[model samples]
Structures are given as structure tokens and as C-alpha cells.
Target: MRHDLRPGRLVAGLALILTAVVYFGDAGDAWQSPWWVAFPLVGGGLVVAGVVGVIARSARRRPESTPPADRNRAT
Candidate 1:
């Protein structure tokens, strides 16, 4: 099986999982954090993911330079 790894999706999924964990912890009274923290976390995660995706796309679109072949080679 072949699989492709997407950095943006990975980051976004991690962010969502973290947010859920935070909420779960709060609900279970394990620890307490500002309720607004999740907003920033999720927002920042998405922004970072977007930037990463843009960079990856640009990198993929860039042309790769190959070495020039020798001109004096015998046929």
C-alpha cells in the first residue's frame, strides 16, 4: 500500500485532538485552563497548517535543476 503524508492535515488533526483532550481534562476536573485557550490553539494551528501547505505547494511547483550532460561524449 502506498500512502501520502500531508503536513497540513497532520497538524490540523493534532490540533483538534489536543483541543478535545483539553476539554476532556477540564470536564474530568484533571486540570483547569482558560476556556478561551482552545480558540487560540485551534486558530493558530490552522494558520500554521495553511502556511505549511502553501510552502509545500510552492516547493512542489518549483522546477528542479538537473546537471547538464557532457557534449563531447562519444556516441
Candidate 2:
């Protein structure tokens, strides 16, 4: 139920919107930049963002329990 807009999904959505514009608006000819280029470019960006997001999220996550020896030392 976590509906957060993570980096990967956000990139995917943006890419999809751009694809619609390129294909439906006939922007391909206007831009003269191969429409197919969007897929790989967006895909790569998505991967990079996903990796960075994961690394950041994990770093921000709450720390696990203290070391086992500390735990056994009891209060």
C-alpha cells in the first residue's frame, strides 16, 4: 500500500508521457531526433536514479540493533 513515487517509477512516467508526445504529436519529424532514442536513454536514467534512490533510502533507514556483545552486556 506504499504509494510513494519512487525515482524509478517517476522516470518511467515521464518517459511514457514524452513517448506519447513524440508518437501522437508527430514530433519525431519535427525534432528529427530518432524517437527510438528515448527508450534506452530513459531506461538508463531510470536505472541510475533507482540505484541512487535505493542507496539513499537504505542509508536513511533506521539502524538495526546494537552489536551482539553490547546487547549481552545487559543494563
Best by TM-score: 1
Per-residue alpha-carbon lDDT of candidate 2 for residues 21-45, written as tens digits (9 for 90 to 100): 7666565466555657778757776
- The most accurate candidate by lDDT is 1
lDDT of 1 by residue, 1-75 (tens): 776567888888888899999999999999998889899989998998898888777876524553345443444
TM-score of each: 0.73, 0.48
Residue 2's C-alpha lDDT in candidate 1?
75
At residue 30, candidate 2 shows an lDDT of 61
For model 1, the superposed segments whose C-alpha errors exceed 4 Å read 62-75
Which pairs clash (backbone N, Cα, C closer than 3 Å) in model 1?
none
